[model samples]
Target: MSPKRPIKPGASNTSPDTPFNLPDVGPPALHRLPLNIAPQGEGRIPVDHLRTPVQSPPSHHAPLEIVDLPAETHITSVVVHAPIEHFFLAPNQLSRLPAPNALSGIRELGTQKHFVDLQEGGTVLLGIDSENHFRARLNSDSRPSGPRLERVEGTLTWRVKPSDESVGGSDSRLTLKRLRNPDDGPQEVVAPKRSSTSTGDGWSDPWKKWDSPPQQSSIDGIEVDGTRFLLLPRGTDPDHPIVYIKNPEHRVYDFDYMERILGTDLMQQPRGAIRVPPANQWEVDPNLPFQYPLKQYIATYFPLLSDTSLNKVARHQFGLANDGDMATDVGLTRLRQTFNDWKRGNSTPHPPLADPLLMLPTLATSISGSGLSRTLELPTLTPEGSLQRLDFDLTRQEWDYFKTTHSGADLKRLMASILNRQGYDVFTPTPSHYSPALVFRRKNHSFVFFISLHRVSKGRTIHQPLNSGPDAADARLNTQVGYPALQEMLQAHAENRLVWLKGGSQVHNSQSDSIFIVRDNDSRLGTLANL
Candidate 1:
């Protein structure tokens, strides 16, 4: 006998209608177990014998999918009652319509022909016919949408009706068409040249130089060198071009060049002597001069002695000179005491008082002895029949040194000295400010100047006011902290007074400074005058 086998449901070994059965087992009496006795009336089952069923989460919704559509061409139309002249006057208004981009938007490409080219995104060519109708065609095979097309044709019809009693001007209807593929024409067409000029063709012919360099040939009376004409635009349009001649060659001319050319004086003064107004005057009140000892000092010092003479006097009094070695100590002591007393506004102890050599009477006598009389006389030409040439070689060297070595304060002093010598009353505020460093008054006219010295970089040698932060644009002197000074200067200028800004050299090693006179209409100091 074979080993006993277990049976499965619905197998060939078992009948389909037979009841499901378990395998052979031991007697029920042997498998039974005794339960523990609980207290009477309790209603609880054993927790270890119980089991819970497992559960799964609910299903989720699926995500969305995207789709793309093809681009479409758009067409728009408009109707208006306006004169043809009005449309011509403002042709730019037509470009405002919704259309493709243009190569050269609404520009006149031809002269007097009323022929204008309207390119559509570099792919279509449109032109205005003689009847004022718009004709358009695809200049290339490419289309904005779908596959490459063979051709495209479109028309913009402008139907106009004459003005009547009802309408103020002409009535016109403008109809535009949507671009579409055409069936009859060839593909890959080239755009027609919009302009007949060589420039309009996008490039020039290499052989065209034989015709006198194009547009310049039309210019009459002026001879143009090849290089010069090539640099300029080739057209008759009135665009002003400025040509700068840098480092021009110096031309040598004979002494009689002017005489040979004109045979007479190029400039002649009037027969009568032109009398100029006096520059110098008693700036301080002559009657009340005693109040200003400083003014007295200036007057006494200027006319009596040169700077060299003053230096000599100082050296002698200080015992620094060889000649002063023989002087007595008591005499030197007395001289020093007298000078100190005079400076303190007290009378000198010496009988002669202030140096007799510095007295006005003695100065006048010395001037007479030098053959310069008190009487004023006009200057005449020298015995050589030519005006005496001023020797400026030494002056030029001194100027160079002064420019390089002097500080801003030194420049201010120099300017003040020059103005005072020219008979102008120069004044500086007690508390000095950077802007408007000096003021000058001559008769009724007054002027002010802002002085500056800035370093140059990158080979730029000219001082530009706007290049400095404090003097540029919104930070200009007029807008700076000391606006009152600028206002005063502007007011003086408005009243026909001179206003200037003195700019020192821009180079570190140079001393070429300038005085820029400000103009009335502009913020810029227009002209640069040499200092």
Candidate 2:
């Protein structure tokens, strides 16, 4: 039996079977403005009809839904709000928010569709994307250093609440539910939703679009840049190992980009943003079930990290033509998923290359190092493995708290703790309001991290220090690493106070290599060099 199509709840005359459309706002849909009034209605789909489908409906794509917001119709104008506290941070999941700055926009509660404003002037953006995680899932493969995939002795449920929650059926039902971050992070607890329901379950998907994601490399019509977003392999598409799709256009890469492909603005991804790097055919690793590369240029330029942010200038170079030519965005499941699809029309399968390094030189069969040589250990480099590495640093509780915190001081302290654990002799000097700083010594090297943390968790920007100098005492940063508010970082040789403050343990300024550590609020860290 086919599943029932959902329609917005509306007037008594509206049929439950008929799908509903939102009343059109002015020009292209900006999704920025908040609805002054919500349409009140009820949806009653018979349970038997919903249960008719034998395969799992992938409604909502598990947290992040793959929706292409057209240029003219997508980006919305939203008022940026400060970080709201995660309820778990409160004594008993009870949180108190300060006075409302302003109601920004309606946000979907259960899915990753919430548009956020990290600051007063921040604009929310969207685009189309694809991911490829060419993973080797052979059960026989094992790594003693890697985490074992076994059941744990604990469970955590948590979620982030956009101020004006867009209605969702799944979250609206449960009074107390265990929830998790979209990625493999900690979980938290939340109250029942305003869109109340008694029928939703762990298996339920109000936005069921697919039961399981396709295994094939999905080519998207577009991509975005200037923002970062993580893409974990969701599912597979074995039927079409290589595919070219002008997949729903306007696929935004960041979980946010362009002023035109941006919010409240009617436009496609900006043409002047950035350009993609050149592609090399040998990058594809065909030894696996799917087509992907063991060592590729795509991952090199992008850097193996926690996001799928593509720059607008970087598109159209990967064998793509037409407006949606570079279809590397819809990739799911592996490295090949993202770029292999982009190379589709021009890419072909090649046999695995066999090369070996005999450490024993193959002279003596019974040599002690006879079996020392091993094939490239590629599992650790897999996309799945790359994302899992982040799970090591945080729990559901800590990660959620980090997101909602407005205290730069909190970030400084957290940074201190993390470094201390990593064998750094951390000395915590009092942190300032905007320009918080931390100093530590590892071995002979002593350094200061002119640190800037996101004012809000995972917001696009980190809070840089004021442009004022030490001459302006009060406005100057307490621990002057020496950068204006606009300057990215203060170098090691640029006036050394931190090391001297550490009981006169100052080393040569250049030897310190005082660095800039920035937390993007996305559970990822970055550095700024002073070259």
* Global lDDT scores for all candidate models: 0.26, 0.25
Q: Write the per-residue lDDT of candidate 2 for residues 1-531, one digit (tens) a residue.
A: 101111111122233442322221111112211111111212211121122212243343223222333333322222221111100011111112222123433222334332222121111211112222111111122311111111112311111222343433333322323344468377454443434433322112211211223432252211222222122212233242232211123343322322222232111221111122232111111111111112222222222112211221122122221123222222312233323332332221210110000000111112123333211100121223111111013345655665566576776666666555433455554646455555454432233333333332121122222222334542343343333321322344254312211100111223321111221221011122112
lDDT of 1 at 407: 56
Q: Residue 123 in model 1: shift from native, Å?
A: 94
- Candidate 1 — which residues are off by over 4 angstroms? 1-406, 429-437, 444-460, 465-487, 493-498, 501-522, 525-531
The candidate that wins on lDDT is 1
- TM-score on alpha carbons, each prediction: 0.20, 0.20
Stretches of candidate 2 exceeding 4 Å from the true structure: 1-392, 431-434, 444-448, 456-459, 463-466, 473-475, 479-531
In terms of TM-score, which candidate is strongest?
Answer: 2
**TM-score of structure candidate 2:** 0.20
Candidate 1, 1-531: lDDT as tens digits = 101111111112223343222211110000001111111111211111101011123223122222221233121122221111111211222243343224423233243222222111111224443444443222221211101112223422222222122322323222222122244244333222211111100011111121234554453212222222112111222232211111011111122231121112111100001111252211110011011111122223223233333333333332321123322223323433443343343444442223312211110111233332221111221223322111111246545765675355555555455445434455553233343255454432233333332322224322233223322533344433234555555566566544433322232224332221111212243312100
Per-residue error (Å), model 2, residue 530? 16
